[model samples]
Target: MKSSFTFVCCMILFSALIKSQTSLYMPLDIKKAYANGTRNYDGTPGKNYWQNSADYKISAQIFPKEKLLKGSETITYFNNSPDTLNYLVFRLYQNIYQFGAPREFGINKKDLHDGIKIHRIKLNEAEF
Candidate 1:
C-alpha cells in the first residue's frame, strides 16, 4: 500500500515535468541555416559559416546654431560570401527632414530643410 502510493506520486511528478517542457520554435531561415550546415544545433557557427564585414572611416562637423551637420565616411566592405556582388545599398535617415518627406507627426517649419545633399560619391577612386 505504501509502495503503491510512492509509485503513484513519482508517476505524477514525471508527467508534470514532461508537460512543463516546451520545444523551441525555429524560424524558416534558422532551419535553412541548420540544413545548410552554416549553423549548428548547439548554437555555434558551423564549418560552412562565413560572414561579411565592413570598415568605416568617418569625419563630421556640426553647427548647432544653424542646425547643420556635414559628414564624410569611407567604407571598405569585405565580401566573404560565395556569390558575386553587383551593387551596394545605402540608407540616408536625414532625408526625413526634406521639405515634402512623409512623416507621422507634424514638424515645425523651421525644422524642415533641404535633405542631405551628396556632393560626390567615390568608389575605388572612381567618382559617381
Candidate 2:
C-alpha cells in the first residue's frame, strides 16, 4: 500500500517538474559564493553548504462518524548543517483557535478545546 502511494506521488511530482521546470531564486550571498567558487554557479552544490532531512513514520486515522481526524508521527531528524544546534523550533498552528490567543479576528468558542496537545517530546530518547 505504501509503495503504491509512493509511486503515485512520484508520478505526480515528475509530471509537475516536467511541466513547470521551476527554478529556485538564489539570494545575493549565495550568488556571491558561487562567483567566489565556494559554491557551484549552475546549482551543482556548495563547498560549505549543508542540508538535513529526517525519515518520518506517520500514521493517521479518520473517523467520519465522529467527524474527527487523529494522527501521530515519529521524526528522527538528521542535522547535517554545518552549524551548531541551539534549539529546534516547533509551530503550533492550532493555537490560532485558542479562546484568547491574541488573534486578528475571532474564533468559535466551542473550538477552544485543548488546541494542539503534545503528549510528549523527546530528543535522543530523553524528554526535554
Best by TM-score: 1
Off by over 4 Å in 2: 1-31, 35-38, 64-68, 108-113
- Expressed as tens digits, the lDDT of each residue in 3-117 for candidate 1 is 9999999999999999985987889999999999999999999889999999999999999988888999889999999888899998878778799999898888887988989
> Could you give candidate 2's per-residue lDDT for residues 1-128 as a string of tens digits?
99999999999999998998478777999878887666786777767666788899999999867656688889988998768889888899877875567788767776764466677888888985
| Number of the top lDDT candidate | 1
Off by over 4 Å in 1: 1-29
Q: Each model's TM-score, in the order given? A: 0.70, 0.62
Question: How high is the CA lDDT of each candidate model?
Answer: 0.92, 0.79
Model 1: what TM-score? 0.70
Q: What TM-score would candidate 2 get against the native?
A: 0.62
Error of 1 at 59 (Å): 0.6
